[model samples]
Target chain A: MRKFTILAGLLLAVSLAQAQEYAPPKGDAHNGAALFQKFGCYSCHGSWGQGTGRDGPRLNPPPAFPVVLQQLRTPRREMPPYVASIIPDQGVADIYAYLSSLPKAPDPKSIKELQ
Target chain B: MSKRIKRRQFLAGVAAAGPAISLISTTGTAAAQTAPASSIPPVPNDERSLNDMPPQTQGKSGSDFMIDVIKTLDIDYCASLPGSTFRGLQESMINYGGNRKPEFITTLHEDSAAAMCHGYAKVAHKPMACMVHGTVGLQHASMAIYNAFADRVPMIVLTGNIGNSVTRQMNVEWNHSAQDQAITVRDFTKWDDQPQSLQAFADSMVRAYDLATTVPMAPVLITADGDLQEDTIPPGMEKKLYIPKLKMRGHPTGDPALVQDAAKMLVAAENPVIYVNRYARTDNGPALLVELAELLQAPVVDSHGRMNIANRHPLNHSPRREPTFANADVILALEPVDIWGLTNYVADLIGRPDLPPRRNPNLKIIHIGSEMLLTKSNFQDSQRYAQVDLSIAGDAESTMPSLIEAVKSQITAAHKSRFAARGQKLHEMSAKFLDAARQDVAYQWEARPISTGRMVMELWDQIRNEDWMMPTESQFISDWPFRLWDMNKPWHTMGGSGAQGIGYNTPAALGAALANKQHGRVTVAMVGDGDFNMAPGVLWTATHHQIPILYLVHNNRAYHQEVMMIVRMADRRMRSNSPNLYVGTKIEGPNIDYAKIAQGYGMYAEGPISDPKDLAAAIRRGVERVKRGEPALIDIVSEGR
Candidate 1:
């Protein structure tokens, strides 16, 4: 089942890459951080897009820009549809850049509390 | 001996000693008259002289008899704040009766008093009394009373009333008095009464205890009228006032034929799954369930209304309920709080259209519980109805033994081998689920503004060896304890607040700790910031009463659940400029200092600690305080679930 999920995800990523006709504008990570909190995206996704599993999925190492935009416009599950009116194209690109900018979580072995 | 005979003997003894008491009094009077003028101290002008002394009434008041009734019922605690209407009863309990058996536990609010009873009963397995102050107090306690009623917990509520307007002293008494005080809570209570005489009060109290403790248990109220409580008992009425003997009723069991049929269904099925909620009433309850599951080699999904199964048990498939139900040939639910929500898949869509069953289309479902035995129309706690192949009306724990015996009679050698193979597969599945949960927690393990997962794991690591009781729910902490902790003891967890009330966690945890104090177990609870704010004064009550508990505030600085809902609402409306969504939902602007709040209440406390590195040491200090018989609190600035 894990293998099947990985294969399906790769195929979707390839299809989204082929379908995109234009590149998104470069985004500012600092401005994206402010926009993330302003939009209340941190409520479901954490303050850094680290999902709680109870409400939303993790977004660190975010998917391709087109896929994120598509999901926001028309959510497939319980997530509310975030149309362009609620979040413009620039806002989505900035949110993606902020998610990408987050540092990788430290190893559990390195944290004495976790051990 | 009858109380009447004892009263008569006491009166006769007083009559026999009357001459001796008169002679001593007359001698003292003569001696006072002959005393020297210089030896007697002169009275101050401000104080009244001895000649100005007035007469005072002296004898047992009606409240003395009420205290006797309470003592007869063997109630250990009475949780209440002082009120005027029951002031007579309170005085009698302390001075006349010595207040040993039913010690008064002072509380800051009536809701906390009632919720204390709610939490205490789950661990003590017996009802504790809470005194409500007439109409206003009853209204204050109504929510906690409703929570206990919905949870099917037993408790006694004694409300004071001044039924006679003539005897009311002042404006406050008039305001507090009421004609039908118990009526406010009658819909939710199992039984209520306003007893007019001491004999009547004795009989009614025994009846209330019986009704409250029976299966499908709930809170019961008996109004103690102010006038009745203060007025002296008539000279010879003591003979007629006899305490009634309490007789406990046996729990109902499933019918023999129905039990046989249910057992047959389980034995014949290729894949059977057991679902349980609020099923374990005693330690023996979990043992019976374990026996039945082993007999059938079935996977048991504990819905956690109580600690129904060991978390590390091989047959416990709580984390894999969806897949287990999908493949199940036979499903048996024991005392399920919501059968429909468990079986169906309802999405939170725009319309929330009727969803089909998530289980196999041809699956046979059986339900056994006493929930249908007692219900009311005014409250809608009875969840949505779900159609089932078999419905047996009985207490699930009481019926489990009979069902297990029937299953044992039918098992053959061929069935044994098949069951063994199924058990092996389930054991492997349980191990994999635990490993996956461990892997999931490793994410964001060292993040600042500490992850709830890391906080919970740190606390678990400290207290896992100590005999500990967690009286609060785990939903706000992302249910990390359920996934990681090995909760084999019955008191390891006492499910959620039955009515989903906000203020239940703090007082209820303290109440459970009060019960755990005698058993020498460490009590720990993780309360949400929203829940803690509802009754922060409960911390003072815990400190005053010396009820030891380790309270961790999962301080997300927001009513985070509502934040998600508001976000959903905004996106659904396609609203632009949704930045101010946290107006009503967020608890920020000035984050509450829970550590100072706990300190002000005379409890040892630490933090607003956002660093995961500091959590372990702070939690250790709190645990050490609790171990030494003191209350403690730790505030962890954490992620929203």
Candidate 2:
């Protein structure tokens, strides 16, 4: 799922307007995967990054690394803000790499349940 | 008598008396020191009385008379878990009362029993009685009682306790008995009584039903003593027992002067809105509210406490609550539980429970409900105070007739034209929201790991045509059904758990299904996996009673809501390396097989169906089974949120 996912299209239109001018630094996917669970990002976003429709949007095929970093640094809505002192720049880059590396949601038409 | 002169005879007599006195003192000390004030056993006047003729047993048990009183109240069902304290009454209900009017429903847990009553009341519009084992049962049932109280649903809670210490068994009975069992639910119950005699039980039972069903309805407790239940009616005492005339008082009306004033304000306002929660008590509730809203052409925002109005109605503004409140000049709040929340901007951020008023500076708020008529100092379910320009202390449904008339009288030819113009704009806004919602579902129209929206829409496709009632928690299903489905009936969606308890959805939904069974309404419930695990046994009761329902499990496989909160905490703490958040929160290591669990409870079951394509068929089969008058379940694995 992308930034223009289903529920986010409905609920978080306001939060999606954050500027994404700055790009994040490159980081390792393995460390990112480990940090994703470590930081408890899986709580609102699924363990595999399928965002809770009402709570958080799907992060798979995450937004530009800069947008992800920006959202963490300064959340627009109910999401708690994460400052650099907390989730340092390195941590944010790794988490973004992990999210970006995840597989896209399978096509519903191809899956038996969605048919 | 002359043998007392001998030393041997004197010694024998002294030895026997010594132990007897010692035994008496030991019993006295234990009773005085350890027993509760009411449970203290009286010291024996003479040991000979213990061996005397068995105490005269009553020819007619007092429980028989108690059953007669219960019969008078016309309760249709009585849910209970077995306990020895109420054994006599339980027996009388079966053998004497024939258990037909208020049939005994054996439940596994007291909470489930209470929840069932809660759900049953929402649909039946009358309370179903429930009996639980004394103090422990009430403790188990406290959460459900709180939920019922918060929802303002009427329920009659009959608890059993040993009234006579002399009749109590040594250990278990002592543990089970309370001097005043009503204290257990004193904070939440509208009223309660520990009836000492059959007559008192009769009077209290009638009073409890009256109070529970009155405006600002709530659960009421009546603790029946074991001795009173077991003891035979004192000879001719049956003639003395009087069954009080069970009368449910007409709902009180709003004051005429205040009604006129509120009507005038509403009529004059440029932009007015009606916010309602728990406004409906019967089939009449939604219609009455709609009539008033239509007359004024005002937007009505249902909080989904009860189905106050059809969501698809042009006047319904639920989807646009924030904007509606923002623009309102006059806001009429009816029976809303969270008046403060409706009127203010309460943020979800840390330590800020309240923010500045959400409405306009000069917004005129007129609140009407029996909220002011019933309240308790303990257990603050009532939200923070919200200032109101006018407050009417009466039942919203009852007061609506008079208020509607007043509004009708105030509307002139000029006002009629204004109302039409306003209605058209509101209708357009509603249409826009509906269109947006329709498009929103199309985004993941066929997404794998079925979207909650897709899943609910799929279920809706099957049941939309049936006379359906969905008794579910709002959070579990999200906003999909409300946004998409035609909730045109009062029972279309019976609303959320009153106290926001987790275990409520499964059992309460089942209870609603039981009520729907008689009416031939197809019942469906969307329950969370975490909630189902709380009281899976409800499925057994459904199966045993042949109460058909299609139970759909939103198997996110976690306490997803809590999971969200925990993650936020981890982010704030900068514990970027903490993997233990999942340890306590997620239900993953050995993911539960919900389908198998439902089968174990003897319901037709299928699932752990992850593929969205599989949902429609599974749901169809489940619906078929329910239509065949059997319970069924479908577990659909999906996104965590």
Candidate 3:
């Protein structure tokens, strides 16, 4: 079990290193927004790419475009795999663009309601 | 004409007139009219006139005996809608029984009545009676009955039917009458009987009560025959009839040897996780689980079946089940509703293929629960089977003390330091998880259509200090309450509808509030728009009975869960999933005015409040009204999912 944990930690580190080097191809943000809703990405991930505790993870500062595409085609955990026949590569790229376009959430300390 | 007749004289006069009328008919009409005034005989002083008078009083009825049986079982309330088939029993309940113990609570629909019993049982720890008219009424209540059965909550469903076709008068009577009335809900309920005699009715009532209250409990049905309910107790038969004493059955406990084995595994494992659902039968359940988890310093994952643990406890890792389970070498599942779903991950894809187990493949599992004891083939409430290393057939809460004792006996001094270190690490992890949740909910925190997370936090801030209970499930709103609130009490939440049925929230919440009223607890619920619309009349029931609760409608204006599923389907087909997706699923075109509906039911209400800024004030007002013993509602137009 300890060996498995160490191996998992190493894999995560490699993924993080790879994430730093990757740069996504430029896509139209307007079309990306429409595509995000079209594919129903906003159902689990909220309309603004903010996720919920019980559903999806936060996607605003999304992982690398390759990682996102890989997850869509062959997903891990409970997410259903979207084969190439369903969502093409261009659609995945648009969704990535939409996620990247979302601004960072406001600091909770600055929000009076949260306080 | 000049003299008023005496009581005896009047009786004689009527007898004389009867003979004169017959004599007139026998003779010719012209001769009879001419002779009637002169030929009528003088009234006779007859002894039979005194004997012919009708008796002024009916001493006892069969329904009065039925009430006696109900009172004997100590059922607190009978929630019902008036129907002709049960009129005899209903009248006797109010008039003869004085509506005291097993008080009559009028509901607008039979479905609401059954649901009220479902919610009442979870908190009261006993069954309440739901009386319904036969056929149509039982059909109306079938979904709620199925919900109670699936939840393993005890309830007495008394349905009225005219078993004898001869006694059925109107079209409705014949329509409602059935040869076997219990058959409608027999598929779901644990036991059902249509008693032939009053003595049999008494016996069945006691038996049903005992069966319902036993471990692995479920709803039971007793069909009261309309004729039997209305008929007089036969001559000298009241003495023959007997109300049997209610037999209290002890909950099944695990075999001592097997319990010991489970304890040893839990103690020896490096990382153990206790997964629980519907395990907390009483307030003591949480304390027992706490003792067990702290002894081993194991993380506990509550599946929100009931309030199984204090949410703020450092060992509680509900929001982090995946990582906790991933590291677990041993798992002790306590009455899990779906053990297979918890241990394995299965995606709802095109073929619905089973994935590999989420936990360690060799992880030892110990199951302690009586879920298998009461199961039927027709309704599939029994979830898919999962193989376990040790299976103990017993009530988890009842078997907990012995398991705790066994673990104590096995633990050594060496284990204590290791356990403490494990506890510290878990505490740090729990704190970090909670901090992450706080950050996640901050996105769009000030949106115009209020975020469900912000809505939950605002409500929590106002009622955190009060003795509060949220009877409704929180899944629709991303389960923000479970993530954010400090839910320490047993009744803090009542879990979800056992069958995931819609229309459960409105009535069930009121039922829980009804139970909480006696304890002076402030009750709150957040219902979905679709659910509230299914049985909004339950608000009228709450207002009439004065069941205090703050009901907030999470009005997303669509069956949001269905909308998500439809979107997934469309995406799977590679079609447009949006804009047109709202066609069938949306609850709009003219959005429902829930505030107006609540006001019509005489409940204090506010909103269609859309702004996040306005939510806190509206919540405060609703809470105040609830505290003053009035039901209140706030309809918040909010984000879907």
Which candidate number maximizes TM-score?
1
Ranking by lDDT: 3, 1, 2
TM-score of chain A of 1: 0.78
Score each candidate by Cα lDDT: 0.84, 0.80, 0.84
Residue B301 C-alpha lDDT in model 2: 89
Alpha-carbon error at B304 in model 3, in Å? 1.2
Candidate 3: pairs in clash? none
- The alpha-carbon interface RMSD of model 3 comes to 2.8
Put down candidate 2 lDDT per residue, B1-641, tens digits, no spaces.
24112323322432364554334324433442353445666656675556566744335577866876786677989988788878988987766665666799878889999999999999888899888998898899988889899888899998889978888899999999988888888999899888778878877898889988888799999988998998767666655556666656798778989999999999999999999988887899999999999999999988888888998899999888888999999989998877777766666777866665456778888999888788889888877777889999898888899999999998999999999999999998888776666654555555556777778878987887788898897665557778878889888878778888879998899889878988888899999889988888888888888889999998887887777677677667766445476667778879898899989888899989988778888999999999999999998887654
Expressed as tens digits, the lDDT of each residue in B45-158 for candidate 3 is 573467566643454678977886786677889999898889989987876666766789999999999999999988888889999989999999999999989998999999
Cα DockQ of the candidate 3 complex: 0.46
| Stretches of model 1 off by over 4 angstroms after superposition | A1-26, A63-65, A106-115, B1-55
Superposed by TM-score, candidate 2 places the C-alpha of residue B595 at a distance from the truth, in angstroms, of 1.6
User: Candidate 2, overall lDDT?
Assistant: 0.80
Candidate 2 deviant stretches above 4 angstroms: A1-54, A57-68, A85-115, B1-58, B445-448
The candidates' interface RMSDs, in order, read 2.2, 4.9, 2.8
Going through the candidates in order, their DockQ values are: 0.48, 0.25, 0.46
